[model samples]
Target: MSGAVQAGYAPPTGPDQPTSGRRWVRWLVAATVLWAVLLAVLTWFSIRDDPPTVREQRSLAEAGPVTDRAVGELLAAAGDGGAARLLPDVLRTGCRITPMEDGAALTRGVEVLLPGDDARGLLQRVADRLPASWRAGVETTGDGPVLRADAGEFVAVEGHATGADRVRFTAATGCRPVGDGYRPLAGGGGPETDQATALLRAWGGPAGQVDHVAAACPGGATARTARAESAPAADRPSLADALAAARGGAVGVRATPEVYAWRAAGTSVVAERVDDRIRVTVTTGCDA
Candidate 1:
């Protein structure tokens, strides 16, 4: 028989050759997939300047993956080392702080009270005054961050006769809530007292009728940038409009920019003009 009759038969490819080629292709695809996954993870977790303490964590979110130790550290960063003195709740339950992976956090918070004032002052001011035991449970998550203080909690201070109701007063400047139950925020050298005589008559003074004053001086915070203060207006503009425009969050009504008198949910916010500075006074109790 002739040995040259194999024209229709296809030559077999070497087993090693086919196997090596398949392996190389599979490896290439896997590498590509892994690279894509890594990129996505990095982008999601790219929160800059991780907050160092519980107080700092509050400035971020309220239901995320923050650790207690990290929250404490961020709060410390904002200068809340003595925050428990004012907040009071932290002493009992400590706080949690999670960093934001997305970049929207800077814009979502309460409006910065003044163009000159920003997050830094607000955090520092709030952090410093928080009662050592004042901090409440903290939470941070995909939505945002929240540091619950005992502002709304009825607590007896040394001087007040009636009592005090500290509230969640997130403001622009660093001054605290003062007056009947909030705080006395004085800018450009003003009186550090509340003018609610009716409430006072019903209540009393800080030592007598007053309860506890609330302020925010959260530590480890970067100060807000300063911008030119808005000119004073005889009739305060619509706070709803202003709030809609301002980038920061709930600035203390006592903030300096322009005394903006307005109302939110039936709450009266008074705006006062002092020389070139504008101060807004609000009966702050913003939990909403």
Candidate 2:
């Protein structure tokens, strides 16, 4: 009862202080925002520096040289006696890179005519001759024996028997965006061109268009191949007789009603009966 108004002491007051929980919440929000920003920056740098995928590394233009190199390697593995020729379809502009999708692809291939009854044995021999780094191996498939290997730099190589007398090997790039397209090697005809023309004339067929493909060989040399196919002629002469006459009566490595193949003077000649048309192909520079 101190009647003189003993004033109850009022506590000194300053700015309002937040509760510990509130302070913790504010700090946590700030830290979280900072971490998000840092993560975003790192992700941007990583994406900018690295390629998205393997297919993006080379466009169609760059793929040509890779394919050519693969073809050269395959031809070498086949040995000098194997009569080989570049596939005519490689010259076409609309060649597909993948069958599953619509995109441009690069393919360089050679068809080697080897006279043998055991097609699988031939593939095994070729596979064995390839570089060990290629990891070449032959496997039995439903169709026949197939050779598969990596040709380095993302090029896939595949080979299969076309028949008992022929084997087709192809180096291809999977589907890719067409950049600048492909440009075939340009050059004049060589001795192979003359042989092709002579064979066509002897077969009583019209002259065919000639195309060339070349690859850089070791020691700064270049191996060039010239190819020509005769137009379909119904009244053509017997393939064996015509081939014999054109090749100076030399017996063919493979002589059947469907195919006739021979090698002479560093060139390979093949005549295949395609849908009743004798498609003659002459290729040179196998040894080169």
lDDT of 2 by residue, 1-288 (tens): 654634796554445955678789999999999999999999898778965457645677777677777777777677554677776335334545556544576778877888666667768887998779889999989998999998776779999988767789998876665677766554346666676777777777767786666654433344566656666566666788777766675546788877888776556778777875666676655464
Query: Candidate 2 has what TM-score?
Result: 0.74
The Cα local distance difference test for each model comes to 0.31, 0.71
Query: What local lDDT does model 2 show for residue 163?
Result: 76
RMSD of candidate 1 to the truth, in angstroms, is 18.3
Clashes of 1: 105
Task: Please state the error at residue 134 of candidate 2 in Å.
Answer: 1.7
**lDDT at 8 for candidate 1?**
94
Worst 10 residues of 2 by lDDT: 88-97
User: What are the per-residue Cα lDDT tens digits for candidate 1 across 1-288?
Assistant: 876648798766786557677889999999999999999887666545444223332332232112222223333333311111112122111222224221111100122232232333444454444556645434443433344443212221111001111112221111112212211222111121242222222211121222222222234221111112233344544434344333134333343243343333312334334553343332322221
TM-score of each: 0.21, 0.74
Off by over 4 Å in 2: 1-53, 89-103, 218-221, 249-251
